[model samples]
Structure formats: structure tokens, C-alpha cells
Target: MYDTLKDTYQLFEEIGRGRFGTILRAFCPVSAESVAVKIIDKSLLTDETDRACLEKEPKIMTLLSPHPNILKIHNVFETEDSMAMVLELCEPETLYDKIAHRPLPEPEAAGLMKQLLGAIAHCHRMGVVHRDLKPENVLFDSRNNLKLADFGSAEWSGEGGSMEGVVGTPYYVAPEVLMGRLYNEKVDVWSAGVMLYIMLGGIPPFYGETATEIFEAVLRGNLRFPPKVFRGVSPAAKDLLRKMMCRDVSRRLSAEQALRHPWILSGGEANPMD
Candidate 1:
């Protein structure tokens, strides 16, 4: 058991909170470095299952520590009252917030996609699958550099790892996972495709008033690309999207292959935000 801090970490404010807990900005006393502290309430973790999941996050963070594009976890400590995780502090908003403000320019969107793919590829190489890959989970540093965060739903695929449990945001989940089919790293690639589509087209490819309708559309595997909205979107771009979002996991392009697609390689002047 860990002792509770007499007072909250100074020099920051409470920025966000969710069902799990709250996130606050704090300065490291030793390095004077700024970071985000995720505080998980011990009281909320009433079962062994919840405790196991909480403990797994730190282990996964350690495995992913070396990746440049992934968020860096500096420390994990348990107080009598809460479990605190110190993470590198990101900037004012997430990718989701940025898109909500305005659609991304073509170059900017492509650049972000490239960065995210680099991160995902690194995780795959390490035998970890980020079950949840969505715009909301991607954050930006003060320099506007992208960092992948939120590994609460992540799982390892290496020897002795379990793949059970239905997880991931509906908008970005691959068909295989939705259908209860066994899946692998390709699921991340599918979610990446959905994210890229939203970045380029200004809205998700599939949206419905209800969750059932959205899942039905996803299962159908027909993602419409409106040329008018996605004006100047290259054929290569469309092709890559189709390959990544394929219903059949085996048919989808791997993250590495998608990174090298002609559309991604070709530098064009078209800006989606224009």
C-alpha cells in the first residue's frame, strides 16, 4: 500500500476527468518538468479484475517506453487514496479537439498520419496491439508533435498473452473485432484508415443516429468516399483507404505497406482545409 500525498501536486490545474479518474497537470519536483498525472481512485477499483487492469497499464507502458511517438510514462506510484501515473504533458488539445475546431489541411493530415503510423508500427514490432486507436486517444505536445496515449485498452499478442475481451471505440473498430473473429495487428491499421478518412473528409465515413445503425454500416464494409467533400483526394489515397478498411482482415494492407503507398509518397499541393 502507498501513502497519500498530504496535498495535490502543485503548479497545475485539473484539466479533465472520466469514469476511471481525473487528469491533472503537475511539475516534477526534481526535474521541474511538466507532466500529466492520471489519478485512479482506489475506491472505484472494487474488484480484482479492475485492479489487474490497472496494474497492466504500467507494465504495458514500460514495454512501450522506447517508442518516440508514444507518450512517455515517467513514474507510477500508489497512494493510500489513489494510483498516480505520471505522463509527459501534452499540449492544449487532442487530435479530436483540433478536428472539431476545423478540418485539417491535406499536408497536415498526411503528416499526422505518417507520424501515427510510425508509432503504431513500433508497437506492432514490440508485440503490442493498441486495441483503442482513435482521434481522441492521440495527443499533441507543446510543439504540436503527435503522441499516441491511452493504453488502458491495449493488449500484448506475444507468447502467453490473451486476446479475449471486446474492446475499442465503435467508430474505429475493425470488422473482425466487431464480428468476434480472431484478429491481429491489422485491426490498428483499420482504425488508422478511419481516422485518415475523417481528417481528409471532415467527418467519419460511417455515422448514424444510433449505435446499431453505425455497427450495421461498419459490418456492410462499404465506406463511401464523397469526391466533392474529399476534393483533390488522389486515387492512390482512396485506394489505400479501401485496402486498409477492407472487411476481410487478411485483405487489408499492413501498417508498413500502407505507409509506403503511392498516394502517401506522392507530394501534392491539394489541401483538404482549403
Candidate 2:
């Protein structure tokens, strides 16, 4: 079905490479604009899990897309030997690239977090769960506007809602996910919390040398804010982080609730982002 993708999209430069495929910056001569394309070799799709994971992506994006901060898909198709997805060309950078060097100005960080939360709220409202939420998966366009990308780990929440799957980056995985219990979109909130912790402190709240050790530390749910580390961070910021980073999924703030948190909505009148 997508055989023409080869003739339609002319690869320009490689943008990224992942476990499953190569992402390239390509131009579709017919459209006269650049877009990102993920070309998946047929050999990988034959594996049941790989195909199962990616097959739903096009449909999911179609169902819950068009949110300003959620990555948008232009087209998706498969041919006899490969599958491809043409997507919006976000800047070849991620949230991590920005903050990993130094934290953004606090108010600016708050505004950016607000955008991220808004995107996640949109996903939950549509009954879609972004099983993976981390800085590496969040992108920024040329305007510095945020867009959530990498939906390969995303899943649709059906009527029953709760799902069981040990997925997501180790440092950001929620307590329930680490415990092997049924989980929901709240896991994304927890992961977002971990990302927040990193953005502010320049380190994850829980850390260990190995994944197993890290999982154990995460399960303990011990959080720390040494004065030197969080000195300039506002109390309201800490308050929201604690709530979002809560261990009990039931107690954690939902995405909508989080958006309304004081730190986000009350960052000050002079704030241009408000």
C-alpha cells in the first residue's frame, strides 16, 4: 500500500534512529514541504510484538490527535516489504537537550510544564495513554512550542481502563508499574513528576546503579529536597511536585487537576504565558 512512499518521499538527512526503525527528514515532492518519516523494514514487523505495538499507532493518532502539543501524523501505510509513517517535522531536539545542560528560568519552566500537562490532559480525555513520558520523548518545534512525540509505546484504554504492562523508562516508571500491578494514565503523571524533579534538581528523585536497584528505590517512594538543591524553587512548586509524584496512584493529581495547580495557574500576572 505504501510502495509509493519510496517514490514520494526523498530522504534528505537522518534525524534519529531507534530500536525498530530509522527516522529521516524527507521531502515529498508532491507536497513541496519537509516531513519526518519512519521507515520500518519488513523483517522487524514479522515479529508479532513489534507489529502489534506499531499497528495501532496510525489509528490512535487519528483518534486522539490535533492537540497543539501532541505530535500529529500526516499519513501511514505499509507495502509488501515495509511500513512508513509520515509525520510533522518537529525540531531535531528534545526537552532533555534543553534542560540537561541547565534548568530553564523557573517561570518559563512552569509555562512549559503547563503545555506538557495540557497535551497529556488531551490524551487522557480521549482515553489514550502515553505509556512512556520522559524528556527524551518530548519535542520542541522551531517556535520553541512543545510537542509530545514518540507514541510507539502508547496504548488505547478501553472500557475496562486499567492495564498491566511493565513499560516506560526505569527512572520515570510509576510505583504501580514497578510493582507489576494494574495501571492507568496516572503512570504518565508520575513519569512527568520524575521529569519535573530532574528539571529542577538536575537529578532524578530516585537513582541507582542498576535498573533493579532503581526499581527498588522508586518503590520506596522516598523524595528529598535538600535546601541547596531546591533553595530557589518555590513552595508551591514543591507542593505540586509532591502531589504529582505521590506514590499512591489514587492520591496523585490527575492531569487536569495538575494543570490547575497554583504553580501553573498562579505563576504571576506579569507572566506572558498566562
Candidate 3:
């Protein structure tokens, strides 16, 4: 199998690594382009959740794909020891890295949010929910187009529209999720709202030195914008943020509704004055 993989694509050095696999740069002779090959060692999948995600990711990506913002998966290969996924090669830097430098201007942040919500909307429409929606999962291409990646934590919401599990990052997890209640696709909206807050404020709205403290803050559900941090952010943008991050799931904005927000429709130009 290793020899077959070697013969199939011109695999290069490892570009990234995680607990389950290493991402390698490779050239696909068939496609005549560079691609990222994620090779997951089956032996390392120690937990049921991890194993399920490995099986589900490829199928979910295939079902919800062909969207501009979602990362494109080209092919899949498997063997007794490992599974390899051929994917579009994106820039090494993630949105997390980009925001670490400085807060993005409204227009720039709006552009990214537009792409993100579009992808989320598509995912929900396909009955898939991306439980993890952090900036680290968002990638950029050479042309600077946003590509939403990493569906390892995603789940199929199905017709029931409710799922149980305490999954997601502390800073971005929704209140209902923290309470161990059944949650739906709105979990992604809460996470995206947290991303927008970080993009505009350069810090997560809910913060603490420890994960427990962060979780506590999240449960408290106090949404605020410090004057110094949010003075320059437009009111329209803030309104959308509030809607997205609302603790009450019923009041939270769906990705489709968020797309129609004046701030988004105008590319962050609506109500420019704070």
C-alpha cells in the first residue's frame, strides 16, 4: 500500500502534524497540481469518537462540498494501516495566525464572515453541523480565498435537528451546550460569533486563564464589548454579533439570516459610524 501511494502521487515532506495524522505536500500527476495528503494512522485512533470522526469526515465533506468556501477534497485512499485524503493545498497560515497580528478592519472581517456563514449555511442545509468552528480551521489559498477546513468534530444533525454532547472549544461553546442540553446547528453560529468578536476585538469575548474558568464565563453568558475595544466597530456589525451570540437559541441568528444582515450585505459598510 505504501508503494502504491508513492507511485500514485509524488509525496513530499510533512507540512503539518496532529495526534491522528501528518499532512504532507504532494503533487498529483492526474490533476497536475499540488495537493495536501492527510495520512491518518489507524492504530492511533484510540477512542470511539475519534474513529467515528475519521469515518464521517470524508463523507460529510463530500456531501456538503462544491461550495467556494468549504475546502475541496479530491480523493481518498485507504489501507490496513492508514487512510490518506487528497485535498486542495492551502496556505499554511490559518485565520488564527492572521488575527494574532492585529484586529482586522471591519471590511476585511466582514469579507471573511461572509465566506464563513455561506459555508455554514450550506453545511446546515445538508444536515451537517461543524461542531468546531474556530479560526484555526479556516485556511486561505494563494489567491487569498477563505477555505473552511477540518471537519473532524462535525456531525450529521439529520431531521431531528437536535444532538447531545458536550463538544466544542470552551471560549466558543454555546450556553445550551455547556448545560448539557440538546443542541442544534445554532452551536456553529455561537462559535462564529465568537470568531467575529476576536476578529474585531483581537480577543475572545469570554476569557479566563484556565479552561474551567473559560467554561464558567461561557455559562455566565455575559456578552459585552468594552468601550476601548469596540468603539470603532460599527453598530450594525455589533447588532449582528449580538444576534449570532444570543444565549437563547431561539433568538440566535441562523447563518442564512446572518447573511442578509446589513453589515454583511454591505460588506461591513452599513451604519459605518459607531
Candidate 1, superposed: residue stretches over 4 Å from native: 1-11, 46-49, 79-81, 160-162, 267-274
RMSD of candidate 1 to true structure, Å: 3.2
Per-residue lDDT tens digits of candidate 3, residues 1-274? Answer: 5677778899999999988989999997886999999999999999999999999999998997789999999888889889998899999999999999799999999999999999999999999999989999999998999999999999999768999898888888888988999899999999999999999999899999999999999999899999999998888888999999999899899999999988998998755434
lDDT of 2 by residue, 1-274 (tens): 5547767778778889878788989887888988999878867665676687888778887776788898888888787677888988988779999888885666777878899999999999999899889999999877888999888788887777888879889899998987888888999899988888788778889999999999999999898897888887777778888999998788999999999987888752233332
Q: What CA root-mean-square deviation does each model show from the true structure? A: 3.2, 2.6, 1.2
Q: How big is the positional error of residue 252 in model 1, measured in Å on the Cα after superposition?
A: 0.9
For residues 1-274, what per-residue lDDT tens digits would candidate 1 score against the true structure? 2233214345368887967798888876667678888889978987776787788888898888967789999878786667888888998688998887556766777788888988998888888999899999999988888999998888887674336556888788887787876678888999999998888788888887787887777888788988788776766667778998988777888888877866565532442322
- Of candidates 2 and 1, the better by TM-score: 2
Report residue 93 deviation for candidate 1 (angstroms): 1.0
Rank by lDDT, highest first: 3, 2, 1
Locate the minimum summed-lDDT window of 10 residues in model 1. 1-10
lDDT scores for all predictions? 0.80, 0.84, 0.92
Q: Between which residue pairs do clashes occur in model 3? A: none
Order by TM-score, highest first: 3, 2, 1
